[model samples]
Target: MNRHESMLRIAASSDISVLLLGESGSGKEVAARFVHAHSKRAGGPFIALNCGAIAKGLTESILEGHRKGAFTGAVDERLGVVRSADHGTLFLDEIGEMPFEIQCKLLRILQERAVMPLGSCDPQPVDFRLICATNRNLRAEVHAGRFREDLYFRLNVFPVKIPPLREREDFNTIAQEIWKEIADHNPLNASEIALLSKRKWPGNVRQLKNVLQRYSLLKPYDITLGNVLTDEFSEPATVADTCTLYQAKSRRIAETPEWNLICSELSKNSGNKSVTAQKLGISRGCLNYQIRKHSS
Candidate 1:
């Protein structure tokens, strides 16, 4: 089996928490669903939570059940995510954003195999696996004290890292797969497929899906490479307008000093502002200011 298939297999048999690390829009949630579908707990519910999407104050109440009188607006008993994922899997997207306190509670539940609901005396047993994903480097966060080391270790068992689309060896195969998916929804000719396959998808699979969706709506009778590479592919603007902007930016970069080259290199290195600043032997704010100046 390929790496992706192997990952699914490992996730299927293991009850240990799996950490999926990948770039944004790299189909992390899709992989998580594949794991849950193939696992022994396939019959159970698959609960997904976006840690970054939830407010800090509501996170605890969301993870643990709340009694009728637990808080101000608690008029009825509410089932927390942990209880909701009873015999299935809890897929936590952007797990790095989970608060340290909530992480402690999560660690406790994973260690004890039980969850103590809010305003509840007794802890209820739960049999479930966790599949957490994050775009951020949790190790660095642990060192920075933004994330708890104990919680990181607890949730990082059987880690699976999904490569970005740009690094995928099976780029042609993936492109073909995306083409088939697009064709299922719309009737795209060979020219359109050829055009799409050549363009760099910075937004990855999600972006590809959106492109196909848009093309289907605005079905052009005669699709060409130029048409597919229009400004709509980048943003909501005319092709000429986007090209003008691109040319202007190119000219500005060309006119800049060696610092622009340094910034470009730094951006290629995952766009970590601090790292860029360090490499340039300058303060982070100076690097930021220079980048802003160049961008303007």
Candidate 2:
């Protein structure tokens, strides 16, 4: 089953803290948002914080809020993300980077259902579900004493592993969905999809999005696979003596009356820009440009 479907099933039945594990750009945050949207707390605030992005010294202040004059620049009292997410969900992205001391504090809150804000004498009760994401292997961190075992167990009550795009069966479906959203200004044709699907996308979804954006801006009218790979599609130098065979293929594409017709055929197969671009053996931008050019 797809990640969304699997997550939907989990969200409908559980209130356990969830841990979303995946590589960067693998849409772990998107999965977290989907879980929140599908859960009972859909109407409540869904606050997201990047644990690794926050500064080391200010981490406590950021998560637990600080009263006015709590620190050097504390001008006004502010609600920490934990308290603000009361009756809602808090998504902590990159939780593996959080300091061990902070993890201990977080474990206390989870165990006591209360938080002690900075510069505050009292501990306030809190009620919110927690979702944490990380790209690192926490088990490895635990071995090195960088992560707390008890905290890990508490947060990992229900773990959801978001598979990378390379392993996903719904890649084409998701690609088409993202393409429609991005290609509203410029439509794609058949040749583009074939070419796009053939490439090894190292950056996954983010890389795909960027390529489409660039294609839309650079060659909105006449994008083609050849145009996208013109600079990088060189033949192996060792086979230079026998390169005439490959050159013959290029000549065939150049001379054939069916070349444009083939592109048209591929475009019809997958109207999405990324897919079409893949089919055309070019970047999405090249396909987008060609589409605009042909349409115009």
Candidate 3:
């Protein structure tokens, strides 16, 4: 993230078109907005389009504008994204999914710096910095004849690759930053933080948010490694546990902030680790490890 931030800082000052390559939820759109906000075109309108979301027949008209009589439903003249974002930045997400027919028009728009609306006799000049993002491998798509090679070359001018969440060295810090978005407080302790770091968040930040949100929505929210890893807290509410999750059985003793109490338990059981572990409702190994940890 440090290196990526540094690149964003340097890239922000220039008007070079950028291609953001990363998995879904890996912050491509976030980076696109960042670049637009810091660029010279910051004062102008910032337009965004998701090519994948648009229907096949409407993609070109929506992006390149159309005259009132261009199509059956065209009652009013509408400006394309390029013209709408003239003198500004245009972010096209999921560019790989754009139909091949519209790709040629988009390429022309980039090369000629002009757009001709459907059924229009004149091509209007436009000026906008382009930023594109995609989770798919455009190179492979090009090799497979699904993407336009020339268009890919044009958009890949200032390529920026965002790393996956697990590969980021600042994992914990980033997770906490994301956690703060939906969480009112940072309730994760050191051990729990370490556990989350070790989790396999396949959906990246998106998955992590769902997970933490699930815990946060508990009858009485409590953040702990055991609660996060187990189904103990997700059980249906009962009269005895109406106000909160069953603390007696659902609460993991590891979250206890009393190291001295463990020592007392150890002494109370006459130094028998097995008896102490049973009384504390924790494994013997866990008790022993905690004993050694707090003793040191």
TM-score of each: 0.73, 0.74, 0.73
What is candidate 2's local distance difference test score?
Answer: 0.74
lDDT of 3 by residue, 8-43 (tens): 767889988899998888888888888988888889
lDDT scores in order: 0.75, 0.74, 0.79
Residue ranges of candidate 1 with Cα displaced over 4 Å: 169-191, 221-225, 232-296
Best by TM-score: 2
RMSD (Cα, Å) of candidate 3?
10.6
Worst 10 residues of 3 by lDDT: 216-225
Residue-wise lDDT of candidate 2 within 127-167, one digit each (tens)?
89899999999999999999999998898777888887777
Task: Rate residue 3 of model 1 by lDDT.
Answer: 92
Across residues 14-58, which tens digit of lDDT does each residue of candidate 1 receive?
786788998898888988998999888999999999998777787
Clash pairs, candidate 3, are: none
The residue pairs that clash in candidate 1, if any, are none
> Which ten-residue region of model 2 has the weakest summed lDDT?
248-257
